[model samples]
Target: MATAINVQSSCSEAEWKARQRLAACYRIFAYLGWDEMIFNHITLKVPGEDDAFLINPYGLHFSEVTASTLVKIDIDGNTLDGSTYPVNKAGFTQHSLFHRELPDVHAIIHTHTTATMAVSSVEGGLQPINFYAAAIVPRLAYHKFEGITVHDDEGPRFLASLGKKRMMLLENHGPVVMGRTLEQAFLNHWVLQRACEIQMQTLAMGKPVMIGQEVIDKHMANLSQASIDPVQQGVPEFDAMVRLVDREDTSWRE
Candidate 1:
């Protein structure tokens, strides 16, 4: 691990808290085996700032990311904080589009897990066969892959395809989800990953037992009315995972 620097004095309270949350997200992603080496990204917008956000510095494993090491940047790709590591340009392009278009989304997760990528490559995208899939299927959208999303021009098409959906399947690529909070973002990814795994396994065996739309709609109605606070929703499970991360290594809290 790199030497963890003390940055408390240098950053505002909001920015510092954002750093801590974003860093914890990185560690949690690593702990859950959701990290894709130094690639892929999870970004959290600064608490009170419209344009500023925190993202993992390129080349650092999610496990090595500490609160002090995350790079702060704006939507224009300018580095706001003094971190020597470069931001992944393609990642910034995709994430920035959402951040700019969707002002309410405070956290965004883009992942390329094996099962999610497998589902993305096939037709039908994400199905509402399972409970987990049903909860998010109503809000999911899809965008065709047009090579790497490195150019600024790609942002418009991405935004157009995304519409208002927070959960998106990137064809031939992977999945991306935005959340109102860091905890929600992590939870969304976890649930989506599990849903994808179930679909892949069931399809391998034979035609899977699919849940009917009426049942899905009934469940979704309750889900829509139900509170989804990352701390309280889904059996209040995110906090337990956070506790597990703290137990393993509290360095992420730095």
Candidate 2:
């Protein structure tokens, strides 16, 4: 169904933070070379809503996103068709599962980048080869790739594997990462992308990059503590990113 032309009411004030975070997530992903143009998605679960969330409108590049451009949707993946924007089926299916099943997770990022999808297509997913891998560690989950996530069945398998975890690699498909906030989720995707890059590069080098499990645990633990106040770091950084993107294009916030 085609989407509607207007929201019943303006987004709640609480949603403002989520929107800004979503936009910042775009800039960071672009910086990491992880954005698949307008195909991939970064969605946020609207604060204080029931099975309602926000996603970038269809047909916009990550670098082109702004706080006001994200569209709200229901758990069933409907665009509220009356929304003043449009959505793609890929973003809907991937984001719906996360918003529906992950209670603690407020944001989700799906990507198809060179290194990330490269690692995903392998017999195995990302290998713990660098400091960034520690941030994900045991929390990382993997989903077998079936195709583009357009079917409802993929939703269950994807959500089941992601059960309470923060990161997932959709094997042969791509990567899906989550967070408690837009900032946190964005950071997760960036680190996960970097980890994939590092893993791929190491394999390319053919040199053994021996990483100790204890060291990985240490870094993961440190990040757990640091996330206690992601706003201080994540929120401000998100604002700064929006300003940066705004310099190039402020149309998203329109």
Candidate 3:
């Protein structure tokens, strides 16, 4: 196993920081019960490197992901760090498309949690009945399911479906979120997962009270105001989660 000192010595300072954050995010996902065994993926772009990004080693469980174990690869799917672990083909297929096309997107998270998948499979998709759902509805995009998403041809169609939205429901599949920062990406996934869980519970009770579009717009406006500070947008929340993860296990920093 590679130690923190060894890994940090081998990478640039910015890249090392990105690796720690991404590794912490994987453990945070596990802590939140958002991981699906060794599947699903969260990727972050290598700072100052246009075509390079970091992804989890193919067979490692989320909890086992450490900074030193992350595999660096270019958008073309070739490993650049010379790690023994292979990159997941499906993960590369999905994440590479967004990273290559969107210059602003520095982080991407894809999940197959039960609530998210359930919402995705529904004909109506996520309803704006809950706080989280209402906020997401205004920006959410949906892509039709095309088998397993490994083929190279599906990339263009997925990008087309994503359009200008940062959050998307892979129809009958799961949710894929893109962010300009890793903090933003984690927060996006957190809210999206909560929205789906609330929607599921609310629907099971009976008829749901959907929020009016005008009210939703107002709510979103308020949220925008609250998030006016770009530097602090998702920082506090992400830092808090990272703290929680560290309390349990700090090996992710390695």
How many clashing residue pairs appear in each of the predictions shown? 0, 3, 0
- The clash number for model 2 is 3
lDDT of every model, 2 decimals: 0.85, 0.74, 0.91
- Compute the lDDT for candidate 3: 0.91
The residue pairs found clashing in candidate 3 are none
Candidate 1 clash pair list: none
Estimate the TM-score of every prediction: 0.94, 0.85, 0.97
Poorly placed runs, candidate 2 (over 4 Å): 1-9, 225-227, 230-233, 236-240
Candidate 1 deviation (Cα RMSD): 2.0
Which candidate do you rate higher for TM-score, 1 or 3?
3
By lDDT: ranked, best first: 3, 1, 2
Q: In candidate 2, where is summed lDDT lowest over 10 consecutive residues?
A: 1-10
lDDT of candidate 2 over 153-189, digit per residue (tens): 7777777787777788888888787777777776677
Residue range 1-254, candidate 3, lDDT tens digits:
33222467878999999999999999999999999999999999999998999999888999999999999999999988867787889999989989999999999999999999999999989999999998999899999998998999988888899889999999999999989899988888899999999999999999999899999999999998778466456788999999998898999988
Top model number, TM-score: 3
Candidate 1 per-residue lDDT over residues 1-254, each given as its tens digit = 33444677888998898898788888888998888999999999987888988889888999999999898889988988766778899889989878888987988999888999999999998887787988878888999989988978887888888887888999999998888887777778888999999889889888877788899889989976876655544335666777889998999877
Candidate order by decreasing TM-score? 3, 1, 2
